[model samples]
Target: MYPTLRVRVSRIEQLAAGIKSFTLQPCDGGALPAFDSGSHIVVHMDQGRMRNAYSLTSALDDRSRYQISVRLEEASRGGSRFMHEQLRENDELDIGAPANLFGLGDGAGKHVLVAGGIGITPFMTHIQALARQQASFELHYCFRNRDSAAYLDELPSTLAPDQLHLYESDTGGKLDIDALVASQPAGAHIYVCGPQALNDAVVAAARAAGWAAGRVHFEQFRNEVDATGGAFEVALRKSGVTLQVGADEPLLRAIEKAGVKIDCMCREGICGTCETAIIEGEADHRDQYLSDAEKAAQKTMMVCVSRCKGKRLVLDL
Candidate 1:
């Protein structure tokens, strides 16, 4: 289990027109735990009623403070809006320890980073690490416009001019996925984080360009929407309880409503914090955290958003 710490915002800065970065300091005035590039924290808010995930935008060597950038999402579930508009310096927030599914390769020859919009948060740390080590890398950033791009002024100075590529859709220029994939050197490791469309484009382009599967890595920044809300019954064998999940309700909410406890971070199905074992039944896994083999096995499910295919599911809750 991850340790939860209460942190206070010591400073806040507007990175872009709609983006704000908050520097958090430990309330106990102690050194924060060490974290690597691409690590993230789960923030508890609304009196623990909601938990949201945010990528760390600060350097790993800076243990005294950690920073996270937030973009005002219009259709947000109150977390981003509260962080951007309501939260003030000196306010306290419950934060989880750093957890990372994205990290630099241990022995990769070349690093190719592709970022879009707010996805640049994790790439910031990667770029800092690469710069310090003088690693061979390139960063391709895609945004809707320059005004909405975070750390625009700070990034260019950190990365080499030739290694950085920026694209703005509103400016009639988009990320040239074909050119990027074609330009990648042999045995190059590709890392991409962005919207679903951008991710799909990169994956498709890379595959079409004959890039190996193991050479490509991606992290999604959006939730998996459930279009076919199928009703199902979940049986918690360990607890000797069962619950009926409505078509619109998620398995996590239904189980929690029955007094069962399950830890979750990003309820959008991106984080794997709420993963549980399935003893029986076919799980319609919708999360992006699981590997292709894991999804094919159907032994585990992300209760936050995944559902059962049949009428009943036996879970080892």
Candidate 2:
């Protein structure tokens, strides 16, 4: 288990129709751990049964409190719903320390950010920090409409004129990803955070435009993985145990039920914390953390979201 911080909900404000901003302060009234602009913290809800990561939207310099915005997910697995419905101001919760899987390019000549809907949260702090350093950047934010755009009004104030661009689907504003990728100057880095479809499109566009894989950074807000696959068997080499993984159950959950402990943060497979070695068998990799090359190698797999390709897998557990 990751270290947790006891925090009190200082404030909660409706940012949009289904989005709310939460202000969390240290319960002991001390400075919270510092984090980078694009960092996120996992909030443990439902007595730690449900964990969800929310991007930090607050200023990076402020250690007194951390602000995160949660969009009430329509198909929520209880995390977003709990934050919106059950959680209230003055409520106390345990949240993991900040972990950054997304951050600004160290020395890129220009930074291009593409955000879709609630995906604009991380860029909120990114743009602020960039503006403070007088960095060259552009934020292209897209949403269904003004009513659904979280912190739309506040973004313009943070970015300079022409640095912020808006695209509303209701207004027939479509972002031409290929054109956007082609328009970027040399040495520019592209960062995207949005739905899986949007993230895939950006990656395809970048690759087609001859951008190096490292130059294109993307973060998926959520992945709709079908966990109900064919059942398989996992052999724990070190423990000398073999466990049956149910068709409807994830591999990681099965390991835990068998009394095998695995340190995992995001069970969604994006964090790579539950990644374990694969001594034998090919993996039906479903995680976004592993690269195509790594998946093809099949030396290891993220058990949280991946499964064995064959009926049995030998793992160096």
Candidate 3:
């Protein structure tokens, strides 16, 4: 597991209709850990019942505090609801150190960013870093309307008029993924963080246009993992214990219930912190962190979201 930081919520502001930004300062009034442009921290809440990743939206050089914006999810599993309703200023919380699953590429002549709804969080810091470096970039932001767009007022003042583009779907504004991909200059890299449908569309368009896989990057804002599966037995080789995982329970929860301590972040499967070695039995791999070839090998599984495909499975533990 990543090392955690004891932080205090110094301030909170409503950024949009359902979005709120939190300013977290070190509990001891010291500097927080430094993070890159596209890094996120896992917030451990509800005595560890919920662990959700929130991107750092503050400037890269600002160590005094970290900012994260959360949207009240309609179908939340208690994470967003707690942040919105229960959490208050001056409250203390534990959060994992910065982890970068989505990073700005090494070298690109130009960069294009596509964001949808709350997916714009990572780009908030990315824009700051890019501007300081005088890098070439363009932002294409899509949202339902102006009122729902988080940071709508700040974005225009932050970026050049020609660099930022907004698409309001409620007013007949639509982003043409294929056209956007086709319009980018050579050696340009595109980064997208948004809904599954938007992600799929951008990836498909890039592939159809013969763009290299390395040039396109994306991070999902939703938990698409269907944790529900048939009941199975997991045997821990080292502990000499076995636990019955319910059809609706995740494997990581079962391990914790059995008093086994495991390191995990981003329970949604985007982070690979919970990956465990497999001694036997195939797994129904559902995580996006592992590649297709890795899933075929069945050597390891992300216990947070992935489950056993067979009746009984053995883990190295």
Candidate 4:
């Protein structure tokens, strides 16, 4: 577990009608840990009542300050609204060290980036890195409208206008995943981060285009669930105890209810803090943090939101 650092908002800019860019600086002028383009920080808010994850929108090389864009989610569970409406300059907030599961590799022949709505946060860092290296890359950004698009003005001037393609869904023409995937050159690497619908479309199209799994990388904003989802019994291997998880209750909650303390940063499964080893039985991996191979091996599981596929799972607490 990483120690929480104190951060204060130094600057705030209204990027769009409901979106704002918050520039944060450490309370003490110490250099923060170096982070990659796709890394994110987990903000500890309201005395740990909420832990929200925000991607690093600033360049990795520039460590003096960090930036994150917050969009007002009316139906939000409360984090985004707090940041967007309640936060003010000089207000202190607790932030975790950077954690990343999405990053670019140097060996990729070419890069194709796809961003939807606020998903552009991480890609901003990717573009900065690629630009510094003068790598061949293209970005396809899809949004509902220009007014709702965060950092719209800064993107065109940052990258070649021709390499940046903007698609406004309200205009009637959707982002043709088939055309986008087909347009990529041979041996190109595809990176996508977006909502569930956009991600599904892109992955489906990429697979249909004969792109190998190794050549495609993606980060999902939400956890994917299995169709036959139901609660099961979980046995703590170390303690030799069992708990019956309720239908709507997550495994993490069930474990906590049984008096086992586990450290968890993001309950939504984006952060790997709650990961614990699974000694036996099949796990229905629902998290976006781990890779397919990691889940297949059943070495570790995010008990916060993930459940078991078998009738009973043995967990290494």
Each model's backbone clash number: 0, 0, 0, 0
The TM-scores of all predictions, comma-separated, are 0.86, 0.88, 0.91, 0.81
TM-score of 3: 0.91
Most lDDT-accurate candidate = 3
Estimate the Cα RMSD of every predicted model relative to the unseen true structure: 3.3, 2.8, 2.4, 4.5
Instruction: Give the better candidate number (1 or 2) by TM-score.
Output: 2
Worst 10 residues of 3 by lDDT: 219-228
Count: clashes, candidate 1: 0
Model 4 off-target regions past 4 Å? 223-236, 239-267, 270-301, 307-314
lDDT of 1 by residue, 192-240 (tens): 9988888889999888988888888887875324513789888999999
What are the lDDT scores of the predictions, listed in order? 0.85, 0.87, 0.89, 0.81
Q: Which stretch of 10 consecutive residues in model 1 shows the poorest summed lDDT?
A: 220-229
Candidate 1 wrong stretches, greater than 4 Å: 223-233, 241-250, 253-267, 271-274, 279-285, 289-299, 307-313
Query: Please, what are the lDDT tens digits per residue for candidate 2 over residues 1-317?
Result: 44699999999999999999999999998999999888899887878756678899998899999999999988875778899999989999999899888888877889999999989999988987888889899999989999988987787787777988899999999999999999999899999999889999999999999998778988888633444489999999998889999987778778877888787766677878888999988899998889999999999999878998889999999
* Per-residue alpha-carbon lDDT of candidate 3 for residues 44-106, written as tens digits (9 for 90 to 100): 787776777899999798899999999998887678989999999999999989988788987
Encode model 4's per-residue lDDT on 204-239: one tens digit a residue.
899999989888888776422321258688889888
Ranking by TM-score: 3, 2, 1, 4
Q: In model 1, how large is the Cα lDDT of residue 107?
A: 70
